[model samples]
Target: MDRIKFGTDGWRAVIAKDYTIDAVAKVAYATALWLTRKFKNPAAVIGYDCRFGGEMFMEAVAKILASKGIRVYIPEQFVTTPMVSLAVKKLKANCGIMISACNGPVNFNGYKLKGDHGGPMFEKDVKDIENLISEENEIDLELLNWNYMLEQGLIQYINLETIYMKEVRDNLSPEKFKASGLRIAFDAMFGSGQNLIKKLFPDEVSMHCVVNPSFHGVPPDPVRKNLNELSEWITHTRDIALGIALDGDADCVTLFDEKGNLIDANMILLLLIHYLAGYRQEEGKVVAGFSSTGKVRKICDHYAVPLIQSKIGFKEISRIMTEETVLVAGEESGGIALGDHLPERDGFWAGLMVALAIVDTGKSLKQLLKEVYSITGPFAFERVDLELNRIIRTRVIENCRNEVYQNFGSFKVIRTESLDGCKFYFSENQWLLIRPSGTEPLIRLYAEAETSDITLAIIEAARKTLVGEA
Candidate 1:
């Protein structure tokens, strides 16, 4: 049997190799066992995205859970991660599972486990699940069948769209948004968020919804490079005050300003933090990932809100959120989990909150961003993905552990943090971070500075250091 390892979120492997039906069945059986042992009335909500063979994999999972006598609620069709989370919260299920990777390439599929509160499983919970997988017992999957499970009333089909729509309606005030006359463009990137915005706004907002499994041969990431068409549409129409793009499973978001310019996640984090703390008057702790910009700290300090930094991953944020009344938890990768909601990141909810911010303030996204920058100062951020051999990547990280940097260009090293990776903080609000990619065999270098030139220089210096060129 192949060793199944779960990453920051969950276990993900290329289909037909590690992600075969047998492997999926084993994981599903183990998850069912774990849930049965934990919850008094074990019930699970299962969902999948529009990935290839998603439905097939979801069916396999459903069969395994049903065979164990655990009630399973499988969505009737492909849906986003948020939909499954909403169902789990509403149905009061013990856990939820999503069978699609978020923003990965076409060939990759994954499984994400959610807690009963509709948040990603805590780190310790994930570790427990991994331990369960490690001590797995052989189980027969051939006897599992959908018909038998349905006849036994062990499996039920649910309309995730209906449940999700009701939640959106209950949370969002369309009348308020319409009164603001804010035109927004939603690009689902051919992922599970395809019809979600349209369903929520209908006649109020204009959207470009598509459900192409190929994702036009590009990964379903909401980065600027993958969203060229969205930029073009926004540029030509000039109708949308903001353009929003959601990842494959609709768990993360990327925004484009009215001028068709990509807004980096750092700015988005700062904007949301400012709005939630200053405008909403919410007083609580704020948590952010290590790779996030220092602008967040500045804003939080100005408001006297406690700021806690975690390693890169929403799971870490989720863990902290459970312990404190976290006002907002976010990562630099466009995943924002707001307070008063499920700890899991939801692009749909984040985008809607941005809309609400605009409506309530009577300003465009650009205007709101300008105000944020005025208070936080200018910050430019960029990342470089360097593909390397696995051994070389390991060596590079080990080398960075002891490596010290006195200065880079004209910036001086202020402090250093080795949280999840090596992050070098420099004077003049400049910093660089280097970490190995969990999902791929690559080293990612992230940097933020006062100017674009300085950011690029910092990234280049870090790349050279990793490659032994510096």
Candidate 2:
């Protein structure tokens, strides 16, 4: 087998391929060894999502950890990524494991590790676990009898969804949500978010809340292209005032306005910051991924809140959220974590907060966004993913590094920044970022300008300049 490696957040591979039983066992054994060293009496909260073989993989992880003499707590049913993270803190476990790939394609499955503080494992801890993967053979892969192990008090199954539901109830204002009288359409994308969101808001309309491992053949990501079903449903339904969709593991979300217009994460992040800082009077540092809109800086500056930019991924932003007083931490993607909540991303929390923000202000999403743009000003953003041949991708990166291109069509390269990716600045607010995907053979081009048309134009120009037209 190839060397087991982890990506930005976790280790994911095509199911029945690199993500086979032996692969999971390797990860589990490495985790067990790492946890044993970290805790005197190590325990873990293990859970799985709606992916194929979730339960079987969860059992495999449990068996491996139990064989190592570490106790395990698992959910009675499939749970979201945030639920597992919350369980780690609530159960006081040394760490947490999730059998999910977040929003990866249907054929993919993954493993995500969580720290004791209820967030993604610290970067150092993740490295330690990765190092241990190479020495997985050091762990004794003994198969402890399942029932016998349970009798010995090594495996415990608890209603993790109940605890997570209670946590959600305690954190969000249900009364405000009910009082708003606004119709909401939720699409779970056939992932783990199905049950809880339906139970949490039974009065609301929802879709794709069933156990479909295939995710209806569409990728389980909550992005615009993947969320066509929800968008169409909401747009056709006149009474639905909002549309919310969750990714596979339910840690991230995408929202749509009353008219079914896709509200990107940048606007959502800006709106959340505005609500917390302007309306709720909250204060602290704001941590955002490098791909987030520059408008975040404007919003933070407007509120006198310091803004810190990290490399893309919730793990990077979440690491800082755990150490500092973070008012809000989010990525350009839909993953966002609020202050006074678990440092980990919570789709339910983010959706509820957005709902509550609308209720508190007694305004529509468009109005709330207008309020945000009043401060941050209007900015348009777009991300273009290019799936090119390896040679072409490498050459593009080489050109970007060497500064071979002085202009992109009409947009000149006025400045260049390489904080995380190669960023070519056209003006102060207009820029383009070319970043390669860490886990996949794709180059992502991000463009931000004054309008959506300009953003798309810039991206297209960069694409032509880099890889040329097909």
Candidate 3:
């Protein structure tokens, strides 16, 4: 058996390879053991996204937990990661198991654990479960009948979407959003987030909202390159005011302006913070991942609100939100969690909050961005993922750890910081971050500059330098 290792979010592997039924059973058996050890009468909430083998995988999990005499609650249909997390909290389950790769490639599937607090399980707890996976705790998945377990009252079905939709409805005022005339469009990329978005705003333009386990032959990630269809649709449609996109599991978000320009997550963070302070008259600190743009500091400074920079994970930011009075916690990726809502990242919720900002302010998205620019100045951020083989990737990461890189092409490294990834600073306004993707075998190059062109140039230079050295 290939050893299962959890990454930034959870354990992911290529389906039919490492992500087989037997592999899932081992982890499920371990989770069942952990739950029994921690809780006297433990129950588990299980859900899955629109991934391949979702039903089969979820059944296998349910069977294992039920055979252990544990109560298992699973959604009647596919749901988003947020729904499963919320269900864990709402149902007061001991843990949540969401069978999703979460925006990964089609060939991959993953397991994400949610704590009872409606957010990701802490690092120590996830590690404990991973450590429990062994041959001694094997589960004979073939011997368990899923229908029999359901009949025996050990496994039950639930309607998580309705439960989750209520939470979303309570937080947002759809009437006001509809009245704003700032028409919004959504692209689900054929992942699980489609149903909720469609239910929330029925009239909004939608693309790839249907279920396609293969993700229409592309990864369901909400990155710029994979979102040209949505962008072009919004650009061509004169009435469309904004575009919101959710990734595979509906936990991450991507935004596009009226002109079909991709809005950086940093800008959205700034807008959310500014909205909370200016509109809602809220008071709390802001937590952002380390890879976030420096403009967040400017926003927090302008508002006199405290700021906390965590390592590169929504779970890291989510942990801080649970402990601190955070107004907003965001990652450089599309995940943003509002303190007023659940601690878990909800793409739909984040999208609505930003759109609400436009409604309450009576300004266009561009106008709102200009207002932010007047304070923080205009800046651009970009991330480039370079897929490399094992040999080169190992060499580059080892070199980064030893500080072997002094500069990249014409850009000198003025300073360096290693919180989650190795960050090389060229100046106050320019820097580059070199880190490997936790879910895939790719080195990520992140850059922030005075302009989009400059950000791309810096990333390109660094990419060439890193690969050349490797």
Candidate 4:
């Protein structure tokens, strides 16, 4: 058997491979042990998204926790990641477990942990749980009866979706949404981000909102490459104003403008900051992942709010959100958290907030972006995920570690930074970042420049710089 390990968020593996029932038992037992050791009567909130074997995995976790005498909170239907996070806080459970691969490809599944404060579990806690994975023991899960567990108060069903739905509706007004004269479109990408948006905006356009565990074989990541269909869905249509895509677990978000131009996370962050600070007069720190566009600093500076850069992953910024007063925090690949609400990323809320911003400013998405750029300046951003074999991936890391090349094809390296990954600066407004994925066997190359052409050129240059000699 392979030794189980966690990644940037949690344990994710291909279903029926490393993500089998026994593997889930091991992780769940470890979680049970950790909870029993940490709290006197540790209660847990558990849910799963629209993924393959979600119910099976949720049952495995519930039985394991029940056998260990821990209270388990679960839902009858599939729910989003944020729903479980919010339930953890509302139920005051010790921790939460969400069973979804969170935007990974259809063959994947994951176990995401949340703290009692409704955010990612602390790093130390995660490491402790990881260390306990090897200390697991065999258990007879079939011996546990669902009715008996329910009667014994070991497994209790909670309507986590209703919990999240009310919070989102309270913050948004359907009347105001209609008054804004802007049409909105949402693509759930066939993951758990369904139902609520339709309830909120009844007349808006929506697609892929059904429950398809396979996600139609499209990894539910909301990045631009995966969102071409959404772009085209809004374009050539009559007066559709905006397009929003949410991932499988509904924790990540991506948007498109009126013309179907992709509004990547970098632009989303800037627009959010502009709205939260300038329009709403909110105040506090803003945290962006290390791979985010540097223009975040400029916009935060314009708002006179401090910006903190965390390493890649939503958890790093979430930790700060739990302890500090963060107004906004985001990552390069569309995960965004509004600190005023919760420390976790709520893709549904993020989408509504974007709409709220549009309604508040009475402007189109492009006009709002133009206003943001007027302050932070314009920049195009792109991230390329390259699947590399062991040999080539190791070589790329070595090259980055040893400073193998000083320049790409034509872009000269002026400065370098390695907060979470190696970033090579070509000019004040242009840079390339090469970071290995903690959750997958891939390397992500990010580039930012004055235009989309330059951004693509930077990525191509970085690609050749790393693989030219391999």
Candidate 5:
């Protein structure tokens, strides 16, 4: 009877409260029904991260699927999101499910659904599942069985880690990487990326990989604030050419240069665009979310590639990717969907691509970034999350809908975009976006400028406006 609503990625809630066994059962039942109706006795590949109780949740869902005469393939051990995706594609399963909160706090957990193509389901597919949830019959608790399902061959255990490692080996060019002799350090942050560096590189790279479920009490977001140890280690070691950080589910990535500087997602986006457009000489369009930096536009313009800007979610980018030959589709957040791969965001793939780019160019990651800056000029970006009561948050955003900004210090609003939220574009390629966070009771302000000071000032002014102080 609990209200189970899916958010930006999937349905995530505090484990015992909203994500109770009953609620998870309901989701599993709904998914089974949806899959049965859509495919011929559909089978699913289920995976889980190293989060607490992840395996239990996976087993619970698998039992639910098996009870409904649906085949279920559960991983033998903890696996990353990309592994589930790969299994979905390799086994030709009807759907893929991963049990993880995906960079959220330790107290939370979630479920993600991947389509047949091994990518996040399209928005309409999620909507269809939601619709089915309302009409489906509640699952019978008496039908769930741990041993009977295994005996009946309804639930099969698979080796997703081996499958994923083989895929990485086939796709990644180790010879090119060894040519550079670049020593890379990876901080898995106690998420699913723990074994990836060792599996992919073997003895070729150095790494600091740990699978601590606590993640030192901080949410497993790969941002500068949470990656202090990685930064300090990279700085002091000096042998690491790059430090890669992956979130809890290993579906998003952030990088640190050899100098221990956290390279923002915008910089990564630009780097991918430059490599794909210039080096690979791939002629295709680029898609990015509105909160992304304008440096993407500069790179696209320089390469004469078409660029499409969409709303804040990677799902929107994924939608565009299906219709066009998108070279790269990414958001301001760490989610990246590369060309020819599944349209879903995979941090493991992103990290591998970063390594490949460095190898192909025969340059250090920092040197490659320097080249990108020379082409697009320098850009600084930042975002601030302002927590508020839900009612107050809604009212503040509604009130700002038609509000006009005459001036903010020396800046003037030149244009406004209300596609996802209220984005006020100012002169000099600087802008501020005010949008309500879908996953939390907060308003997020994203701003970018040519200098850090200007970016911070814009964020401050936007905060004042949100609080009615300006």
Candidate 6:
């Protein structure tokens, strides 16, 4: 049996190679065992996105959990990761499982486990479940007929989307947003979040909602490059206030300002913090990923709120939010959570909050960014993904470890941080972060500076250094 390993988020494998029914059975069986040991009558909520084979994988997972005498609650149709997490909390289930790989490529699928707190499972618990996976625990995947389980009261169909929509309506004021007179567009990227924004803001929102498992041959990530079409439309349109995009399973989001300028996650995180603290007069600790910009600390200091820099991953930020009084928590990947909302990352919820900020403040997204810049100062950030072979990747890591060069291009390294990646600081406000991807054979190079030109230069210089070009 192939060992299924969990990444920073979940266990993702390419379809047909390793992500087969047998492998899923092992993980599902392991999860079932863990649930049985934790609760006397374990109950779980299961869901899937609009990915290929989502139904099949979800059914397999449901059957395995039901066979173990664990009752399962599943959505009647496709749903997002947040929906499953919300279901766990609302339904009082012991755990939650989502079968869509959040933002992965078209040929990939995954399994995400959520705790009863409406967030990711604890890292320690996930490790324990991984340790429990073995051939002995694997059971007959079809031990109980799915329909028979349904008839026997083991499998219960749920309207998770309906339940989740109610929560959204309760938390966000779509009526206020509609009355604000600012038009907005949402591009679902053909992921599971399709048609949801329209349902939320029928009169105020323009939508590009569709269901395509292949993602129209593009990865369903809400990054700048993957969102050119949406950006172009927002740029050419006259009255559009901004554009929003959701990833494959709708756990993450990226935005474009009124002028169609890409507002990456760093800017969004800062905006969220400023809105909550400065506009809403909220008070609590702020949490951000290490990969996030230093502006987070600047804004937090300005607001007199505490701040903690977590390792890269929503799971880390989510865990801290549950334990602390977090006003806002976010990572560089666009998965943001607010203190007033559920602990889990909800792109839909985040978008609504952004809209509310624009409405209440009566400011454009660009103007709100300017407000944040008054504290953190003007800065630009960029990332480059270097696809290198194993040998080159190892050599690059060794070189970074040894401090091979005194500087990257002309930028001098004033300091270096090895929290989760090798962050070479050119100055207090300028730095380059080099980190190996946890799931792929690639190294990511991140740079930030006071200007976009400098940011681009730093990335180019770093790339040249890595490839021995200069």
TM-score of each: 0.95, 0.96, 0.97, 0.97, 0.95, 0.96
Name the lDDT of candidate 6. Answer: 0.86
- Per-residue alpha-carbon lDDT of candidate 2 for residues 357-453, written as tens digits (9 for 90 to 100): 8888888888988898889777899988899988888888888888887899999998898767788999988999998886667899999999888
Q: What clash pairs does model 6 have?
A: none
Candidate 3 TM-score, true structure as reference: 0.97
- Give the total clashing residue pairs for model 2: 0
Alpha carbon RMSD to native, model 1: 2.1
**Positional deviation of residue 254's Cα in model 6 after best superposition, in angstroms:** 0.8
Model 6 bad stretches (over 4 Å): 135-137, 204-207, 398-405
The residue-by-residue lDDT of candidate 6 on 90-146, one tens digit each, is 899999999977888889999998988899898888898899888654687756598
Which candidate should be chosen as best, given lDDT against the real structure? 3
For residues 1-470, write the lDDT of model 4, one tens digit per residue.
Answer: 67888788788999998889988998999999999999999999999998999999999999999999999999989999999999999889999999988988899999999989898888889999999886455677888788899998889988888888888767666568788778998999998888767767878889998898877778888876778887887887858777889989889888898899888778888999999999999988999999999999999988899999998887788899988899999987778999878898888788878888888888899999989889978788888888878788888877888888699999999988988878989998999998789899998898999998999998998877666666
Residue-level lDDT tens digits of model 5 in 347-374: 8787778889988887888899999999
Per-candidate clashes come to 0, 0, 0, 0, 0, 0
Give each model's whole-structure lDDT. 0.83, 0.87, 0.88, 0.87, 0.82, 0.86
Q: Pairing residues by index, what is the TM-score of model 6?
A: 0.96
Quick one: how many clashes does candidate 5 have? 0
Off by over 4 Å in 2: 135-142
Root-mean-square deviation of Cα positions for candidate 6 versus the true structure, in angstroms: 1.9
lDDT of 5 at 239: 81
lDDT of 1 by residue, 236-336 (tens): 98878888889999999998888888876677777788888889888789899988887888989988999999999888888788789988888888798
